[model samples]
Target chain A: MKNNFYRAVYCSRCELIGSPETITAELQSILATSRRNNRPAGLTGALLFANNCFAQTLEGEREAVERCFERIQIDPRHSDVTVLEFGPAVERDFTEWSMAFVGDPSATSPDPLAVALFKDIFADNHADSGAKVLLLLRQLVHQEDLWAIA
Target chain B: MNQISSQPPIQTDDQNIARSVIRTTTSDQAAALRESFLVIEDGAILLDARLRVMLCNIPATIRLGHYGAPPSRGYPLTKLIAHSSALDADARTTVLDRCSAMSASDLAGIEARLVFGDIVIRIRRLALGRLLLWVPASRAAGESSLHDPLTGLGNRRVFQAALAAIFTKPNASAALLMIDLDRFKQVNDTLGHPVGDALLRLVGQRLRACLSQEDVVVRLGGDEFAVLLQHLDGVDALGKRLIDLLSRPYLVEGHLANIGASIGIAVAPSDAHDPSTLMRHADLALYDAKAAGRHCIRFFKSELNARAQARLALETDLRRATALNQFALYYQPLVDIASGRVTEFEALLRWQHPSRGIVSPAEFIPLAEELGLIVPIGEWVLRHACRTAATWPADVRVAVNVSPMQFSDSKRLICAVADALTTSGLPGSRLEIEITESVLMHNNAETLETLHALRALGVSIAMDDFGTGYSSLSQLRSFPFDKVKIDRSFVSQIDGKGGSGREVVRAIAALGSNLGMTVTVEGIETDAQADFVETSGGHQMQGYLISHPVPSDMVSALFSPQSPIASAPNPEPVAPAGSRRLRGHDHEK
Candidate 1:
């Protein structure tokens, strides 16, 4: 078989809207569908809900990753979807799960990275906002508190 | 007493009948409430909807006797308490207006304290139009305990309790004002706490005078006060007024002192509904107000919270900025007009934030200073710029800005600069350290000594942003600076026909030359501006007209053979005494 696919990592941030019950239900459904859909496409990543915002990193074939992001941009449960980073990666950052979840779906405990990311996004002085946001997400994974099995 | 003497006392048999009637008709809970009301030593009374006195304990009868006759069943409650002088006028009106507006089923409650001469009576309007009044047994003790002994203001405990009571009501709209007095510690440290105590008392008195009677003010321990204003829509103007009022000079024990207050206002039903959240929000606003240079009012907003969180995030990122190798140095050339060649390059700091792309120094420099990260970052920039500039043609000097904060510890900065020069194999004379006027404003021995030592090491010292500082000429005379960069403001206005801006630049350039120093005019863009600098005796010029700040990799081309600086022929062969030639280096070619 000819190796014809290139892997890319794409991350985006969005504000989660709706009540806790609705948001949790929506998140659960999203995870279920994302896992079911991404497994066949070999896409894997983690979704973090904190401070009413989501930071997700998806790694897979470049075409599949871009397509997944296209669907997420129009998702009704969230708004202000901003792609912080998108590029080829040597390997998967979230290889264990297709759609891992960090932080509670109901938005109970504050997402530590959300505050950091929001600051960078809205900063008047800082430049290279997207890369700083990616670093913040990478920090979350390194911290190990944000990881969900699947 | 006169009214009590006129009216007949309640018959003992009538009281017994009323108690037995209450015991037979009311449930165990009601009976228990009535029994407890009877046994309390403090004055106790219960009134019905029609102002009828349904029950009065012995203490209540004795207390009521002062204003009117002892109350009995069917006696009008309002008439009995009409003569009391201690009921606050404002509270009286509020209770009366609210009582008429409320419906029969509405279970609204009101708390008020009525002072009966030496005693304080606590009154609460309960459900079913029942009015409960009781004098706290330890009223004197309670008053003292609730107040700060030093300032005589309600203490933190009292404020918290008041907040809790206010939170229980539905649709309560108010503003929580958090106040912090600036420079109180300095007063305390220098003049001592006794004077500080007096100043605090004065602050409380001024604060109390500015507020309405209904507003509750509490001293939240150590130069902090919280004021809870009921039914207030916005407190911005009021907060300003309070800050102005509190900031006035105070005479504490024959010593004149000054202080200012920063206020943060958080509104109810908007910022937060609960007490703790409201307090936190108010405190957060206070932090912003203080950060914005104190002595001002800041209202809590979602954006303010976001900005504060962003600031915190930036601080974290700044700590890691150097560690992650996210910082870079950009170079902008400084061209000697006479020679039409690059004399030196200014190394500007840039943060290539992983997400933010290229963070401006304007935004992160101050933040890094606040986080105490500037020293290390400055060290990194110094070393990196020096090392990079070392690879350039030897004649091209590299100038790096030294922040005042970095220069604050002159020893460490001097050591770092020395280390950088030694490690990069760059001659001390090839490096220029640009310092603003504020850096020399301190004029301390250590800072001056540091400058002299660097000069002794053959490093060129430049007074940056001249004509903008407090003492430019006197400072020039005071220190042997090798160069002076006329500020960009004066340079931009040089083309403004016969403007003082041009005159100032000309005079500064003349002074630089007279003092045996090279003058570099900054921010020269237009030809008219460049001509003004050239004719005005400005030795060197730097700005976008030459070239915008570029990455480190692009710096060498500006000095390369056949480059802009290399191609422009020198109009005059006049070189300063030190004579650092730009294009004469044949070794690098």
Candidate 2:
């Protein structure tokens, strides 16, 4: 099978801040769409929002991830266009996702921990932290190494 | 043929000149040989038995010219040689002869000083055929080992000694200026180090030009030069002069360069009497001056020590406070003034310091910001508040106050908000973040993006503490806000007790309405204030009027269903109700 590639981008306006309402709707839509047609191309990684800047690690093949990354730029949600970190080939670090969303839960709230972890940590602002927790979960999930079980 | 026919005419002069040179050690034969002889103006031999000039240089041409013009390029030992025997002669020749004769003997030792003009020539023996070099001792005595090769000025050691002496003298005062050229490294890196070297030399020259004869300059090594100003009455005057000297721009290789001085001043008998102590104090002051901004001058101050101590104290406590779990969140209700209904609450963090007990956000907020701990601390607050609020009624939202530090970063804000929501299982809509008006002043795009990100996740956002910042109309159109909260200042004065408070409130409430934002008034204390807000079409009013910030355990009673309702609500009111201010006063330090 041929491999695919995706290019990352940054938005200047969105870099500063997004109104909670706008961010919420945008994230909900992204999640809903990804959930509808679920597959590896639905893969998305961590999202980090800090210092009026936003960063994320999205994955799948080049086409799928690039399409997702492109929507982030022109979404009218953010504007500044200084791509902080990008590589045409960093490899989709996150393969397990159908548009997982992590955001400031203050905009979203109370649910069971597992479900909240998705909308609260993945698709939104809290994505970075949630990703960290995911990493921990990954460590404990499947392990041929003894360290993983321990 | 043997040695030019056994002690030939030139050979005799060579022997005499070699004898005159003095070598310190017998170990180095080459140096001994090089220094042994003096080339003179006349070719004549001064021997052990007699005295004469030996091994003439070009200067010998002049002497030969005087000897009847060309004198056959040679002179006999007795006729042209002026000096007499060993003792009566111009002693230089006699000493040379004596040294040579000693070196030839089985074992010999001798020393002699023969003066010519201002030069002192010393003679010592090596082997009988050779003598060591003789140089003028006076020139050596006046020479200084501490002179900088390039500047030819006193180095660090000499400056320290001079400063010590100056300090020890009573009534003496001096100021030390430490010149630190800012961005000098850039010049070196960009233009090449050669240019940087030239710039340094140029600075050295310019500084020297600034000093008087009485003042001393020292190249204390690499871009750091010092000037000691004597006869200064006090540090203030000294600092002024030093600043002036360093303020002038220097032209290096046709490039105009500006360098500033962080001058440290010390007055003798006043600041300190010891030289090193004064220098240390001056250095400390210089550090402070640099910290204030480059190009500033400051005098040694004893109070800086106290400030240093205070900074250390604050930094230490900030680190420890979190570990001790000394923090707690307090909630202030946000009432819909028009309806007189409580809709939301603002979460404010307070520290119950073991010693201070209930420190205000104002006191520790800046400290946290400085230490870069506000992000972590804010994350904690957001999570705690969300979790607590999650346990509240479904429609009730908690407003967590976000400082400039907390919201300045998109990544951190995302993490904190996500963590708060995820960990607490609180719905995004139920979680509202309150950011101050000042937060909108910078990096608009980033703030907007972060806000939008948070908002898109179903969270509500509000502009907090309005009317007290650089209020820009553009902010309202650009940033999406569910509500605009008026400052407590205007609310506190709205009873018409103070100047123009009611009018300001009236105007702000109108503005918020015109902009289509839910207007919340903060810090309302009395019923009259509450009444004024209710009449003003304000959407929300919060303060001591309805309920002060209370703990989780008392929330049910504090925000009770139907008590003191100027108006009624759609949902059935829950449990017991009463406004109970804590035993301690509101500590918004």
Candidate 3:
């Protein structure tokens, strides 16, 4: 039997406390660590930080994806972590990047689109919000050339 | 204040700020230092030289509230300790005196450790006249180790503790309820874990809503919960209410999920005095509730325990009986209606326990199935029956009954059949495999593939105990069975009253014949039943009216060339009653 490919999306309240610069540094370190870990595990995904919330999607073999998600759930920097979607998928949407990050944490003003999408995710308590997050991530990654593909 | 700044700075970055805040004694610097402490996961509180609260984080405020001494900026530490309901008067005075008497040297390390009920608070001195107090996150979150994170209910540890506490008081009247959710696995498998988790949380909320605060409810594990009821007066009503409430549909994560609860109740000091015994009794009753069907409740009884003990002994005997070769197969003849000749014999397993004599298949077959011994036993029956039938006339086929468990692994079953045929040197055409509708209910594709493979080997398939299970007609339409055996229930219902039972039998026989399948009416204990079956278009009849299932050695004697049954094509039907005592006659004995 072929290995089942899965994608999981979750949003959590960002518990990291500090000035914007400190939080930006923390987010950059998170992106770097995720890239280093995800490549060896055959995982590819994107992370978004805006409005004091973090939404991320991980896509890989089912077991690897679930293991990475479990680790993220226990990380002290995130709380109220809610999984939006977790199931077998036909194909990977973020295949080019091991960990693609979409938000400028150091910027004085948060990205309006990312912040709006995060607001909608928190406001809507339905399963479709996970799909909406995936669509938003796919669109943001395609629209912006600033994100590093590592 | 300037004296603190002149001293050597702490090695850690955050601690350096702690030293500076104490030296400068500036409100702005203190606020920045408090902002840095927010990054720490533990609850943090800063105290001034007078041991008054200066700054606190959100976690610290929450923890303080839990200890019944909510903190505020500028609040005196002694007053906070005095206000705590968690601490007795002596503990409060001890904590206050310890804090007030701390020397400048003592402020450089952990100054005081205070226990308030289950919560512990640790005080550390950051600098001269500056102390930091905080609670570790693990111990601070309402003692999270004793709670289930998803539902906010107590965990198994809490259940054990509560049970132990109840038993500590002699003559305490309490009831334990073991609840298991039905169809929960289906939802988890189909909807994914998020929805399943959400459903569990909703179930927890509903359970809490049904009972009073005095009753303790805990999520024991996945889809299993336990409730400790202090009052036993309305325990039955509460169980019923729980069943009704849990059975209601739940909308979880945009999906509508339906599930049910089965509860088993055991009361303390009456059913059992010890925690382990009470738990076992509740679990046994839970098994009974589940076996009785979902959404039901059962109470512990002494007879249930006796029955459980008996079953354990029987299971042990069955395991040994299989190894000791204590099982035998009795053959029952199926007579052709038109020619009144025995064309086939169905193989039936009988267990002869050493001391118990003959054990009914009705009692042991289910146990064997549950124990997963049916596969090997079923194979043995096939091989043995084929070996016996190899000596019979070439045209008389032998039928062997197959349990649904045997079909779980189609490859093993097919291999067993092929092996039996090859080893016995019996032709596949001389063997028939009998199965019930349950064999086709699950893994339909695999079962069908196995059936086709068996047919390829030239063995016929028969649907046994037909019209008993649901969707018998649909099952017949799904596959082209060579024979359909009408269950004995309808045959026994034929009292010559021309009721629906007679009509049902006639309709099934007609339906079977119309489908080009042979119909065999079983359990015909009288002439009337046999006559009804013959006139109802049944092709074959097998029942007590012909003869009781006889040993393998006696099967051939009944149909030998010299016997009256073999010489006469339409011989007299065997006596319906007391046929077991009429063993002298060679034919129809």
Best by TM-score: 3
Q: Write the per-residue lDDT of candidate 3 for residues B1-589, one digit (tens) a residue.
A: 2322222233424333333332312233233344344555556666666887655555654555534323445567877666556567887787666666552445333345667776666654433345556565655553444568899887774565456545534666889999999999989978999989988988898787777645678899899999988657999998998887677555455455778899999998799776777889999999899888868999999988998999999999998987898999999988878776677889999999989899999999999999999999999999999999887776677999999999998999999999999999999998999999988887788999999999988999999999887655889988999999989988888975655668888898889899999999999888877767778989988888786898898777445232233222532333223222223244432
**CAPRI classification of candidate 2:** incorrect
Worst 10 residues of 1 chain A by lDDT: A1-10
Cα RMSD of all models vs. native, in order, equals 26.0, 29.1, 19.4
Off by over 4 Å in 1: A1-150, B1-174, B180-201, B211-225, B230-237, B249-261, B287-296, B441-446, B453-458, B469-478, B560-589
Q: Over the stretch A1-150, how does candidate 1's per-residue lDDT look in tens digits?
A: 123233332333444567877777777888899999999988888776767666677777766775566456435465444445555566666667787777665546766657776666545423465556556656666678634433
How well is each residue in B495-580 modelled by candidate 1, as lDDT tens digits? Answer: 66677788898788888899899999999788788777778998888888767788886676467342323223422223232223
- Name the candidate that leads on lDDT: 3
Q: Interface RMSD in Å per candidate, to 1 decimal? A: 29.1, 22.8, 10.1
Q: Which stretches of candidate 3 lie over 4 Å from their true place?
A: A1-150, B1-153, B168-171, B182-201, B251-259, B291-294, B560-589
The per-model DockQ list reads 0.00, 0.01, 0.02
TM-score of chain B of 3: 0.69
Give the candidate order by descending TM-score: 3, 1, 2
Best of the candidates, DockQ: 3
Summing lDDT over every window of 10 consecutive residues in candidate 2 chain B, give the lowest-scoring window. B24-33
